[model samples]
Target: MVEHQDVSAPARLRVGIDVGGTFTDAVAIDAATLQLVGQAKTPTSHDHPDGVAHGIVTALHQLLDQVGRSARDVVFLAHGTTQATNALLEGDVAPVGLIGIGTGASAVFTKRLAGLRTIEIAPGKHLPVEYAHLRDPHDAAAIGGVLDRFDAAGIRSVVVSEPFSVDVAEGEDLVADAARSRGFLVTAGHEISSLYGLSKRTRTAVLNAVILPRMFATADLVADSIARAGITAPLMVMRCDGGVMSLDEMRRRPLLTVLSGPAAGVAGALMQEKVTDGVFLETGGTSTDISVIRNGRVAVQYTEFGGSSTFLSALDVRAVGVGGGSMVRADLGARSVVGVGPRSAHIAGLPYACFASADDLTGARLSTVAPVPGDPSDYLVLDGPGGRFALTLTCAANALGLVGEQDYARADQEVAALALTPVAEALGLSVRDAAQRVLATGTEPVLDVVRALIKDYRLPEDQVVLVGGGGGAAAVTPFAGHVGELEWRIADHAEVISPIGVALALIREQVERVIPGATDEQILGVRREAEQAVIAQGADPHEVSVDVTVDPQSHTVRAVASGATELRTQDRSSRLSDDDLHRLAARSLRVPPEEAQVLASTAAHRVYGARRRRPWWRLGGGPEHPVRVLDLDGVVRFASPDARVEQGTVGDGTAMLPRAVADLTSYGDGGSRAPALRLLVGPRISDLSGVLDESSLIALARSELEGRDRREDLVAVLERRA
Candidate 1:
């Protein structure tokens, strides 16, 4: 979903809404300044006939009122919903009738997929599926007979699947068209994925079919309500991979919105925080969802639902059961704190002790009792004027001044100390020590995840920053960063980061092909297809950039394209000046302003480098050269310890390709590998980092430069292989 956002400030406002299990949040951002101008929250209306859609509408209206802007002033509107994911978890889904088409071997393959008959969407609830097949896929009479049986059995949705549908989906399409004509919600396998995996593709499509009716109702309800508000801007929906897709696309692939809640937070980090490479931690009351953003894009992978592996690509988010409201577990006998939480104050129906009045904690005593039945009775609670209040991680952080005044989770320090004073006395340590110990224990689990991600992503050690978002972000990230000794900060409008992500997200589409021994032309064809796909969905074609990656083992060619919906800025004064770029690059490199000198420049970007001087104390660390690639807006898009930069025309780059790749390529016990490279032209950055084979790399390079004028600006940054 991360097509690079234009640095130019646009016009008007954009509204974003996020529907959570408990609350629906909406925020308005100034399109020209990207500033969060107004925000509102309303309790989720689950009991209403309209479901969460009603809450979203209410929040959006409240936000508009606060911002004093009419609906027409908004250029975009979108929301990240958890309804589909929650529906599967709660087993609130319609029955599916699968109409598989094929003959002989394909028919047997579809028949053997009996697992679809009883999928455990919840612990005790299962997804009901009825399977029916036809030899003549185009026979409307045969399809009607199958539908008659399904209708009698109370099935409301249908899935059409066939073998080799990726090659030609006519059979599946014919079945789908017949089903739709019969008023049954239809899902076609090839429409879900163009890959050759029949089983996975069918399963994914089946899951989509189950949620089709409910999601369709919500999308239609919202679209109608938005149109009634006089807003003609497209109503987009957040996808699980950090992009915003049109409402029509959502109606077709509602399953794509699964897990978009987490993706929305990281999308905010990518576009709003301008995070090129880092770990983003979004903490709520119960747990913290940790995800990584590399090279300005969110890391995504296929996700699993109810033990079923699907081709649903979503943000790779890992959750830890620890957050601000996490209750502290202690052992008075051992006089040591055991852990932070797997339970939170909200779940226990208790208010945070840090939010208590100082007078309420006066003469307060700590009593150990389990908040729920059949549990350990060592959780601490304060019994005083407040009767019973939970002592949680938020209280501990506030006590130690770890939660800043400006932070959303911040509370009165005096009240916080009073809440933790009992723990301090029980552990026979100072209140400060108690607070620190509690934080260290609480954040340890999250710290483990952070360390693993940093190493796994090969993030630049010196440049990797830890960004915190969500309401409880201050309760965890600050202390976690302190324990890990890394740079950290809460995001702007941290409480509403997810909605902000939804508002600022770009239009994105990814087209993947399984082409074995693919030629350069084939790769380029995929790239063009992806680009055209996003544009067809409302992206500005001229603003689009495509990244093509080929995997030899799977012979999978994936081209991801993204583009801004529109650009409204044209003034040259908004661009960064040379001095401004130098200061920013120098600060990012942790060197003097004078040391970070420009190494290469394109019309859209500049590569800055700083000399490395390992003192006499350090050996084997010399001869290192670090570089930072900065866009015209002063955002550092790429950072590395060693790299080579070159600027030229298309022809010049083609001629120097051999030297460019050879200079940074490495050789050792393993065979030599090509360097990671990127091409920076006017307002576009083509990522060639994922390509390893030189021939493939050159072919891709030629494809990118094919239509460009010979004398156009081109700059390449090649990272040295380690």
Candidate 2:
């Protein structure tokens, strides 16, 4: 419960709800401080006639009551759900009608689109889609026949796909209009992706189309409930790419919400911890989701659906089946621990042995049995005086003293050690050794994923950190980090991280176009489109920042815009002094205050540089000067191993762009390429790393400063490339 000093006035709050498979969690936070004020949990009402929406409302009401607040005080509202993902996993999706257009080679391409007809969503079940090919999509007569066939097949959602539609979408647009006119929810391939792959684009649209009806109904129900609860803010939904999109945007691109469950937890870690370059591990009762944030941005890539590739971009999260409630799998006959689980005590309706009193375990006998049918019968459970208690990974961590009292998963260490005595006797070892063996076995898989992510992303071993969140973080992440020899910390309010993430997430939208050799005007056009897209979704226009990327090899011009609908930075508490900013940066750098110096300054940011300490045993080149960019709000907005920061006005920065790029560009066998560049113009950290060509980079740099005053402060940050 939130203990407010005064509840007379309406407290400004942001409410977030995350609908998980087993529970729906809601949290309310001080929108300005970003502090957790209240939270509530309710069982996921899957069996209810109203479905998960009922659970959301129930949790929201509970949270409001707990905080002594009302829904009318909520300045922002957002939610993250697993409904779309579960639908695909369970084959509970609406049937879709696919209309393929074009002739000759494109006609053959249309036949390939029919492959979705047998898309197996599960072991024995497949997505139900009916495909129709039309040589001329604009032929109103032909479109009517397709609709009739679709209606006969009981399909209301339609997808229009034509070859090279990314280049020319007029035909696909016309067909989509015709379908919508007939009361069908329609999706066009080109709208989902700007890439030229016909098959991938159409497949992505089909994936989005399959879940349209269910998601629409659920979104509408939740929206109406929120409105009735007195929340006037535009409702947002968490996306799979670690951002929030308005409910309206989700209606158009519901596929983006498929795997957002893990993204929500990572987003919480990112915002709350001010994580720059690190991997976030969110450990749940049954599994852990691990993802990366490089250069202050979450790593994202095209995700696969039902074992097929799609153009949907999502956070690259990897899951490991080792968590707090994971049942221990042992080889009792061999007197050795084998592995941890994908099955958990929670699923088996058993309580953790550590949570029980020590007296309850008197004369307890260890028995190994499969928690679920067909699972290996090596899972250890203790039959005690209280009841049957599962010796889980959480028990192991507590027994080994790896879980502290301050941890969310904390339990009585002595009691945990006593509960594991049965296992110790079986192995002829001390209880701590048995527990150590179990934790090591459980964290092995998680360590593998961490190592693989580090290698794949080329993260600097010295700088990479591991931050953990979720209810079971203490059970897995700390020991995994110890084994992997990485720095780690648990997030505050880890159990409710998902809801906090939803509350703090910014409104985001991305737009892309395939234009061979896109000019300056074309690049800006895409940038403005992204900016407008988020504004349309209720992001404040003045607070919006669009980062544009013009890729020459792919000829893809991409823009990502992010903004806050209601500026949460309120009161005089947000801004800090220059000395405070430097102190914050030093703590973030893990260096002494004296060693951290202000390298440069802009209106809203201070660039602090510190000398990298090298190992005394090994001789190397001169010490590196790494830099961290700290905003007045005391958030580390960016960090790099080494960077060149030069502060000047917009005109000065524009004039110095070429020289800076030339000075920092690296030369190697691969050829010369400019260093990663970012300009701090006011509060916006304009990322120019995506512009590959030198001239184009300059043009983009100038474009970022286009509307700004020539004398406005600008800080150019060029990350030195070796």
Candidate 3:
């Protein structure tokens, strides 16, 4: 139980709930003081993991009681969970069938093989019925075949996809209707991606379909739990994009919540620590994820999901298979110690309690050196707060060949030192360097691993903020001190961090228009395009704002379309058009064009200004004048006969014209044009010299003077020839 105090005259309270696979953590924060008052961690019940809410409410009630405050004082509730990620990853999710129209030629079908079932509608077929136009009209047969397949697999829901379906969803509607007739819950693709890209759009739709059931289940449980706890305050879920949204909306777009848990830690970490411009390393059971935070925001990189190279800028988090609890063995043939991971052992096999039996060879070595004789077989290892299972040092040591009196004869420190060298070498580090890096960091085994690797690589272990959720966290602490300024922090509950990350992430909705060429005008059009979209999304037209960012050298422009929402239904947009090229030309070369073609379009959106939009114009000139021209007058006689001309008669003058220039006398009866070029008055040689650079003048002098000498020499040579 935790205690809290209400110190404000008018009090405000907030609760942050992070739901994970292993445990659910609840932190009650005083909105007025921004101080944490209540915190709880409860073992997660996977079967009805939904039951974890009871523990959360119990903890909150305990805090409220201690503070002598009613539950009504709680004004804001923020939540993060991992239900959606697990549903997708463990294949313990809804059975969704995908109806991909306009995607018959797309690779989404191939990609779908890994997650859900997808059927591409026959191309050239219209809505209501693709077979409507078929001469044979075998629509019934086609429908029956599709339904039969769905029935065999027991699919509960269906997601539909079609090209440009947001605007022309009729085809997708018909497909959904046909699937619905077969008793499948249908989600239209047009309802998902009103944007672009048959493949990416379809993939987004498919992922939504696969995760919707889980999202709906979690949303319902959470809402019910909140109401049951006598809390009327709204419950908000964190999106993958790091924004909050109403649970209702999150259910519809659950894919956005895939990174909710990690995002929350990223958010919580950013809030608690002064970690700027560094990477956040989150180690868990299955993998170690690394993400960078720059300027206090998670920096996202655009890369392909999985193996397919679809472009998107997402938080740069890389999950390496190496984590604590990985298997260690000696490759006798190679005469090296190798730790192999990227896969995890069943938690039941190596419970943390039997440190020796935990299947960690390192743990076994430590136990042997300590010579602590506890009942090895009866060790129960329980994880989370419950501490459930059994483990033994012999299990870990025997597996790694550390046994009997011989191994036990070594001191714990000596054994650790002996193992450290090879481990460092395995990780490509020297013993001392590994120790330094490990000591610099805070987590036990992780820092030890970091140290080993650092030593192996002969690198300095820089102190960093470490975030991990695992049994190995304690063991990794000693070595973490080696790095300078390393602040070691672990998640309140570590095991399910990634799953929680998935829940709190935002949904990315992008819209693109294919406007040809880049130009200043087209750039304006792109912004208008984004604004119109925000308005269409039910935003107050006046509240919408369009901002543009440009990289002049690369001739790139990013336009951001955003709007404020009380409920957080923020829409973000990006447009990549060549229209901005005109601006670049004007800014870079002082020459701007009026119109342009769009080379590309890319945009991402959340509730606020999270996405980018820009335009680049490739072609088109100004409306007032498509071309410009100037006329040059004669050098010798200016409205005068050659005999009356003087060296000082002309004057220096220049003019701007709108179009191609022709000789003033050639176009019509000899008349003056609106604009003409004028020259300076001076001796012929002096006037010519003024306009030319030094090199030109030198060449002119050489040519004239040398030619005279050459002429005289030529004459002499001619006389000699004669």
Candidate 4:
């Protein structure tokens, strides 16, 4: 165990820990001065799963020594890692226990296994699946039985997903209690989400579960590393949802942390400039990340797992896999530099002889050699596609005697100097500036290649800020020059930026309640339960508030329960316990099986709730119980030929619509009755056709109101109205 001094600095110090595949990097900063106080890099050990933990300890100890401070002096620690990502990509997830309740509850579990994984506990099963279709007492009993079976399997957690829980979470809570009593963990659907779309929510749950184990592992490493460093400071991790939580809270929902790396860079960059709107680019050995920040926040694109196109959101970012060590190859006929990569050279060590042959460029370029000699495919090989293509084209041109030897030699040097230029241009950079950028950055052979393209294509030379990282930053720095007047900046820890970036997340959880379209009293009853649940998460019950907005036509009700904690930092003594935090998070994020039933009940109630009042037309005897409503050109014409169509008439030199349209203003007072659907056929000839399919009817009515002859403007009026 390494020990840190108890010395203190004048400014607050925030630490960033980056766990990479090859090394663990740590950067400590004095927040007030914005000065870096310490930096350490330690080799990663892959064979031992806890290698990152040990590396972190080593790095912290080294950093402490350099900064002359003890762990207790640091105010906050932020870290990032790839453990959760690796676990999901490798499919090492446990079999999840699913509980679904509703008419179609079973379908959710059945679908999980098709593209994902889930073990279902249906209404007939012994255990109460977190989700269930419990219509009555018997349904609850069946769920209890399923919980028993899950207990036998020692299943640690359960997910309850029901379609309409946004209205009623009590049913889910009841079922969850029964399962928990049987020793199973329960996650209720309403607690997990309020958004519609059962499939998307379920997928999100599975992804979270898949990443949980790795997240736990990473958290454990952080804890251990802290202990080893003689640090008593509380460790906190950031969430994708834009908040921070103690380490334990983060482990339960790992998906929230997967994108934390890029998010942190955004946060850091924003903080550095005190302005967030701009297109920021971070280039490294393995990939290039371009993110746009708008209105002091990074835009978010809810990208589907492994999908290409991104939906525009608050933040818009594009990542390309073109970087240093990208393969360069030549297609002699096209006379172009065809670079191919998103792949990279292994960061394990330095380059070897075999890599020499693989890089297609005639000049010597830097590369990493594989530790074990075998198939090149097994190694992260940089394709020489772009370099070779650029070289071939230039060589062919020189051979044809189109240029002098001095010029050819100069172009050859320029080709190597401009390696990344060709690829960057392909990504979005202009041809001429791209090559010039290569020339300005350095005289590397790759830069020369990029320069050749600039001269040939006349690309722009606008100055822009550039950030480079990974194993190849040193190689590309020379060629990625300052665009115009903008200066380029690199992340403090280049190779480990991804891991460090992950440290910028917080723990997040959300729950929704289904409010049935019931009487106002019943709706209020359901909302209270949701408010109670929200308060359990360290919120003051008094601070909780409910938002209600209803749509009577759709028989739908939207209610939001929200509360906020005081803006106080965590208490060192009561920092969250790992087990307890996970339990709370899992509970908050899992959808209950009773969701659909709740939604149905809420929907049903919404319709039934409005029965206290009758529509004006239905008030007396409801058309003598047998009147047929005829669909007259999209108008519901009643059989009573003597019925009067009510329309508000505005008598003026220039008649316009009455201040309020009839549908909107025809209601009776005291909420006693609904307004009648009335249309006033005017004296105009077009009015004889009655309500002309809403669109045309409005046109005719407006035309008559404006004193325009309906015969002359009917078609154009209808088209414009539509």
lDDT of 3 by residue, 1-722 (tens): 74333356545566677777767666665554444555556666555556655555655566567555677887767677677666555555565665544334443443343332323222321111111111111255655566567667766666766556655677777767777787665667666544456666655666666667667776787788889888886576765544455666676677666655556656554433324334455655445555555423464443343334222334555555544443333333343433333223343254423232223333322111111233122112223233332222222322222222332111243433443444455446665554343332223334444444334433323323454433333222212332324545554434333323322222222334333334545445555665565555443444444433333334333443444222222112222233343343222222334332112111110000011122234222222111110101101111100001111111101110111111111222442222122111111111111111222222222222221222121100000000
lDDT of candidate 2 over 167-219, digit per residue (tens): 88899999999999989999999989988888889999999999998998888
lDDT of 4 by residue, 77-152 (tens): 7666656545544555544466655545645553442343332222222211233234432376688776776666
Give the candidate number with the greatest TM-score: 2
> If the candidates were sorted by their lDDT against the true structure, best first, what order would they fall in?
1, 2, 4, 3
**Pairs clashing in candidate 1?**
none
Can you tell me which runs of candidate 1 are displaced by over 4 Å? Answer: 1-11, 568-577, 590-593, 611-625, 650-674, 693-696, 702-712, 720-722
Model 3 spans with C-alpha error above 4 angstroms = 1-10, 49-69, 102-154, 166-170, 173-185, 284-287, 301-314, 321-722
Count clashing residue pairs per candidate: 0, 0, 101, 106
Q: Which ten residues in a row have the lowest lDDT in candidate 3?
A: 713-722
Candidate 2 lDDT score relative to the true structure:
0.86
lDDT of each residue in 102-210, candidate 1, tens digit only: 7887788888665686778898888678888888787888988999999899888999888888888788888888888889889999999978788899899988999
**1 or 3, which is superior by lDDT?**
1
Worst lDDT 10-window in candidate 4: 601-610
The total number of steric clashes, by the backbone 3 Å criterion, in model 3 comes to 101
Of the two candidates 1 and 2, the one with more favorable TM-score, higher being better, is 2
Task: Please give the RMSD to the true structure for each candidate, in Å.
Answer: 4.1, 2.7, 22.2, 20.9
TM-score, model 4 to reference: 0.52
